[model samples]
Target: MTIQATNLGFPRIGARRELKKATEGYWSGRLEDGELKDIGRELRKRHWSLQAECGLDVIPSNDFSYYDQVLDMIAMLGAIPERFADIGDGKDLTTYFAMARGTDQAPAMEMTKWFDTNYHYIVPEFCHDQHFSLSSSKAIDEFLEARELGIHTRPVLIGPVSFLLLGKLRDEPCRPLDLLQRLLPVYRELLQRLVAAGADWVQIDEPFLAMDLDESARDAFQQAYDGLAGSGVRLLLATYFEGLRDNRHLACRLPVAGLHLDRIRGNDHLDELAAELHPDQTVSLGVVDGRNIWRSDLDATLELLEQARELLGQRPLQIAPSCSLLHVPVDLSLERHLDDELAAMLAFGRQKLEEISALARALNGQGDQARSTFEDSRRTLHARSSSDRIHNTAVAQRLAAVGPDDVVRDSSYPVRRKVQQAHLNLPGFPTTTIGSLPQTMEVRRTRAAWRRGDIDDATYRSFIERQIDHAIEFQERIGLDVLVHGEFERNDMVEYFGEKLEGFAFTDNGWVQSYGSRCVKPPIIFGDVRRPEAMTTQWLRYAQSCTRRPVKAMLTGPVTMLQWSFVRDDQPRSDTCQQIALALRDEVADLESAGARAIQVDEPALREGLPLRRADHDDYLDWATCSFRLATSVAGNSTQIHTHMCYSEFNDIMPAIAALDADVISIEASRSAMELLDAFVDFDYPNEIGPGIWDIHSPRVPSSEAMTRLLERAASVIDRDRLWVNPDCGLKTRDWPEVEQALTHLVAAARTMRESTSQRHSA
Candidate 1:
């Protein structure tokens, strides 16, 4: 076997979040343009060097991004939307960031989760008369840049077909796929340049292949690769985040020199691939998991490869991590504080790359030479299963005792709706802010000081109290029906809950990119989860003390916590989630006792946690929704239950979402406007719905008239009594001015609609 090693993609944010800081600094005018680009260049050079040092045969270039790769592709193709293009052709990074973040005058383009991952992508907008041109040479430039460093790298591109399919039709009379031929020329030109620049191979990612493709998408894949067939560049057609499954025949027929399969995610399809793969083409077998933090079982991976070798021979094999390391934290070795046992079981991006290299050596007739590394991996795997931290009998007993009644609310939504309406005295179109207010620079500064012990507990508590007081005053002045405590005392929602719970560990410097220049440190759940005490009751009580309106108690849902954290692999994820839910159910009971009539449990990650394959979905949705119901069922019918979902395609999961049984579910709909609402309305969603009226992701404050227009559309589908108004998501990322302006408009819009509805009823 002459197997090689490669990576589909690596994390772009620096191991210590250098890119995040540099990018944010540039946006804030704290750094010059040249300095920002230099930081990006430095990060790329360091990543490429690290991958090369690990003895990988092929490293990926152009995976690095200041904002998003899809957005970069848009700029590269001169497909800049007219809103951002009015400033310039997006030839410079300024226009690029402007398109992503928006200028003071124009709002940024729509951004949503990238294929169910937390990573966000800027949505491309196509007009009816859209045409394409080769505007940027980033792919060629990056390949040449790597070559100059004495390193040969395969440049990665978002495949032409997937790119068009990923886009939404905005001003177009037709879908984006209608312009495939026009877009093909730009890709062809880029490929020709890469081939001219001494590139032998290029990785064109077609992740959309994993989705249920219609005939048109399948045909476009054939046309695209067939169009670029004559180009001298050898193509590695990559698919990850899921398996080809039904699309395996299409994969074999695509005219590419190579095929990459995610063995971790697509383990079931390996036999089919072994039978269908063409003898002439090479296959890159992704044996390690790039999306997780667990160490790979090298012996097991090699076993799978040995079988593949029997079918296709070692001459055609290449090893890699499934999908990209973009989802995991960058480096595990940097954590000097991690316990030895925990550290051994964990593998971040850097460690995962080394695992890929080790697997290659063992498979390449050097098993004896790599014996020590293999034994260590075996030990890590064994230690995780046998560790005392893996189980708690009490947790198991509690789970065993959970009856059907434990996973269902006390009453139906219609009954709860009448009880909630009578108890709360809310207006027809209720106005509320989502669970958080802006966490300003001073809030962050004080938090840092408190963590460092520069400020004592008393001091920190007082500081947070002041912040909450201010937030309550602001909400009252703005006339919001329900208010949050601003979440000033907490850091990340999941992280805060994890810190208070047993068997969860915190990282000091584990910053992972949430989006462009935005980062989050997901907690590490290493053992059995149990709450130490009430997580939100104190804050909920404090915020309610200052206001007569119902103070919303905010809690992160079990699925969101489980999905976001580095969970244990020793047990089924649904088991771990149920354990977390049992703990949260206690907290929910506490908050209700503390007089919080409106509790908003944010499950932004539920839709994201769904298994990528639809065949495996029912099993997941069954447990995921059950866990959520278990957490929130403790609340009485008089209390309003609100759950928020962030940017996601929730149409498929509407039934499961309805299963959550939240009295009110506030979803992100501003970007799609009233389009997402059509689903809820069409389904005759039994619960009250808050279709977001403002795009909180963008800093641009929406006008009352614009928000009222969205609410008007919402009312046309949903009953006026059932419609609640709010921003798309939390306001923690926005500044005070932005949040204040946006919420004012949101409140005004709700009030205007309420008056109009009253007029109709009176008439």
Candidate 2:
């Protein structure tokens, strides 16, 4: 039998982010339902045609969605909360979107991080009395739609176990597994519908199995699959992100028709899993990398797949990506501005499909069709691996030379605080903000005009200076102890520096969704990284010159810069991060020399770089921590280095955070109700801490009383003198009105704290 090739999933956001614009336009009443349906149909048709062109034997359908797969599952299981069910007929497109994004009368469901990726999923809220019935058949509909186009497709759905595990407990503490018995009938119904609709294969994604699962969760997985096994549709259970360590035994014993494993991140499990596979079962060997933009080494991947085939001979091995192609951009060929050499070293979603197809063909002994492509890809991979441009001997040596003395400050916090008090003479409860003010539409228009050469440098500079002056004056009026120039000139924290630095290339339309309504175009680092000139000096110097108040010079830290960018695949990530750190070391020194007293290097993505498995996190954190020190350690003792991190769970990384030795560190704690402050209380972190006083994600302005309560809670754990009050994150996404109201309350909250402290001192 011929080995069938398949995709676990494909990109849902259409090329050019058509789905995003169309979805937003539809919600805003700019586009009619018919027009939106036409866009959706067009996108699905294009995706199916691409898969057909790549010669994938089992092309996936039902993967396309307006928002996210988790939202689709909520709709499928008829788990509509009462608040959202009253919008319209549940089948209407308006109701679907309303569930994803709230309308005037209803607030959107809460969104949370999807696994470890930046993409957010609509959290499924379940009541204690939740009942399951098959409400919608999106899988059957998409399968028949593809069949009408003469393509037989495998329908995809989140497995019953994973779906419930990802949902939330609304009314009571009910484990999602409690609803498994009730949820299984709906899955069986859906699979039977797909089987009736002429779908021979269905892909059930159980990625949560890759994580540490308790006994109840594992039993739920087996129980749910046992009920669905007789539904007539062939089952392909898929897992990604990391290897199935403890779950390997359950995975092997499952009664599914096939099992898919990610060979990129989970390569260590290949041999052991191959030995344990059931003789009658089919194994889908995911040989191509899916999460990154680097081109695959076709020769190497083919060799590995062949080895797996020999171990499980005639087990119907299929070649595919390690995960869905949603994380990567659409096509590298669309990037016209990238240099030819670097372009040759990269692959995106469209190109990765071709790689999978070619690998399958070569493994099946139809080698002639893929020979030319294989030779070309191998040569490119070898050239990159051997290129001298990837290595910086001097930077490597400097990283090695970093001793314990370099990471430590000259004195303790008490001595340093006394010295700082003598120099600046600040108030009791210091009030400052994380850098950035609102980036309005007018600012974007001006930036676009400047990029097109419609405006001169002097005109653009004047525009930026005016914004900065307004920000500085407003901060002064609000009585803030520290001021920021308002990062009006930056498009993004990391992209702004990538634009000014050498050896980096950016794309005009390379947008990856960060969260809801937020996207970032990560720059591609190709050659040896170097700072051609100072990046933030001019704007920072101008802002510092305009204000007597201490201005915090903002920079994205080295680890974050490397994490957010499409880094070079030629070298180890640790080495490349050090090169970036060395570059920032110069920028930090320049900021100090240019009359800046405090500098905040933001490392929000630092925690994200931690390994998914506990076994590998320490090594990753060691290099990551070293990289941060290499950047900030160049500054003097009096410079008051500060770093900001948000959306992080710092309980695990608290020790590494203290090791960086920043004089002050700010984190997002207001949303968590200052619970993260317990880490500081537990560790007794000597550095000054800024636990954010308000959540900046929402537009609602918090009251002074609310902010005061939060500060009081922080004061119970942290010493008042070592605390600084600030917002959770930057204000770039907010409007001026909201920003002003929020900071006004923030300053008022600080005054209340100071009054309480004074009363205690008098007593």
Candidate 3:
């Protein structure tokens, strides 16, 4: 049997986040023009060289992006929004970023989770008369760049159908897929250019084939590839993040040279795929998981492939990761601080590439070296399974002890609102910023110094306290009704809680891009999770002491803690989430005990964690909502519980969100102009709601009049008494100046609405 090793994509953020620094520097004008492009070129060159050195038979180019791949595809097809038409050339960084981050003249395109993953993508906006043309030479240029470096590479592009399916139709009466025919010609032109540039293979990623598709969507895929089939380059139709399932027959029958299957997520359908494959086509088996950090079980994987080898005697097969490695860290060996025991069970993008290479060699019957590598993998798997530290008896017992009563609050929303309102004594439109303020350069440098032991603990603590004091004074000066400690003592919300909790591991340079120039190092949950002590109580108490206003205690919610982390696969995710919920439940009780009146458990990932297929939604929502309730049920009725969600579509899961039962739930609504609040309005959502008035993701500050209009619209649907005012999310990603301007307007808008409401009542 002949087998090849390959990669779908690599992390463009770089080993030490070089791309992030360069991109942000360019945005701030700190780096001159073309400097960011230089960094991108360097990252792509380094990534290609690394994959080639790892013995990959096929390396993918054009997988790197200045911001996101979806936006890249949009640019390649000349689908720039009409608002950005007056900017620079269609392919320049200024126009591209203007579309993503928004110009003062227009709002940015909406963004949401990339399928079920935490990574966010800039949503494509298509008009009724949207036109397509070959607007960019990025794919061809990258392919030739790799060729010049002596590495023949396959250029990857999001498939024409999936690209359309992932986008939105703005001011149009037709579905995005209706424009498929217009989109295909540009794709064909790009493919022809690549063919002319000496490209032999192109990986067209159609991940939506794994999603539940209607008949029209299914037909769109066939129509898309059929049009591009005439192009003179070999097309490898790639599907990841799921198995083909019901679409297996259609996917396998597609007129393409090769098909890649995500065996890790959709292993059960492999037998059917083997039966359905065309004689001349190659089948790439995704044996290694690309979304996580766990070491693969080589013995079991090889055995499965051996069975598959027999299923198709001489048909060419390739071994690759299930999806792009962009979701994972760049390199594992760069982590010098991780202990031997934990590091043995982990694999980053570079390590996953090596694993893919080793598997290919072992499958091809190369030599003793391959066998030795398999043996090492087997040992690591054994160590991971048998490690006593993975199973915490006390944590397990506590989770088992959790009953239905533990997930219920003391009273319903009406009763809790009355007590909370009286105790807090706030205004009609309660104004507050989200949990975190900006993490400035000083904050980052101080944290780094503390971590490196260059500064003493006392010095760091004092610095944090002063920052908190500044934040408090700023909020009070702005006339905000509620307040936060600004989260100066913390880093990434999930990572901070992970550090305080047991059974979680950290990486020094495991950064994955969350959005444009924004990255997060998701903690590795390798073992049983339990909080060692009060995670946020000390900070909450100190901040409360410094302010007369009710200082809110911010905690990352249980569901988010699970969804954001690289969790353990050894247990059902629900069980692990329950353990985390219990841990946070303790933290919640401690915060309330410390006299924290308002506690915000931010679950920005709740909707992101929902199963992609509707059939699986019920089971996931049940556990997810139950987990959130379990965490916050410990708060007293007077301790107003708030939860936050951002960059997500909550309309479908409003019931599950209401089930979270937070007294006040805040969500991202500014970008949509209060369209998301229609879900709450339709559901007659009982809890108090805070429809965010500011789009925190952008640097452009909205005028108070604009925010007031949004508030008036929200009050039109939601009861005036139930409305609260806040930003779409935390201000951490924004700068201090924009944050100050934005919050200043947010407060003014709330006051304007209050006065307007009072005038109407008096009349």
Candidate numbers sorted by TM-score from highest down:
3, 1, 2
Local distance difference test values of all predictions, in order: 0.87, 0.83, 0.90
Model 3 ranges with Cα > 4 A deviation: none
Models sorted by lDDT, best on top: 3, 1, 2
- Tens digits of per-residue lDDT for model 2, 544-617: 88989999899999889987888876668887787788789899999999988889988888787877777788
Per-residue alpha-carbon lDDT of candidate 3 for residues 530-594, written as tens digits (9 for 90 to 100): 88889888789999998899999999998899989999999999999999999999999999999
Q: In candidate 1, what residue range of length 10 has the lowest lDDT sum?
A: 267-276
Model 3 Cα shift for residue 525 (angstroms): 0.8
Top candidate (lDDT): 3
**Model 3: which residue pairs collide?**
none
Quote the positional error of residue 206 for candidate 1 in Å. Answer: 0.7
> Which residues of candidate 1, in runs, are more than 4 Å off?
268-271
Better of 1 and 3 by TM-score: 3
RMSD (Cα, Å) of model 2: 3.1
Identify the leading candidate in terms of TM-score.
3
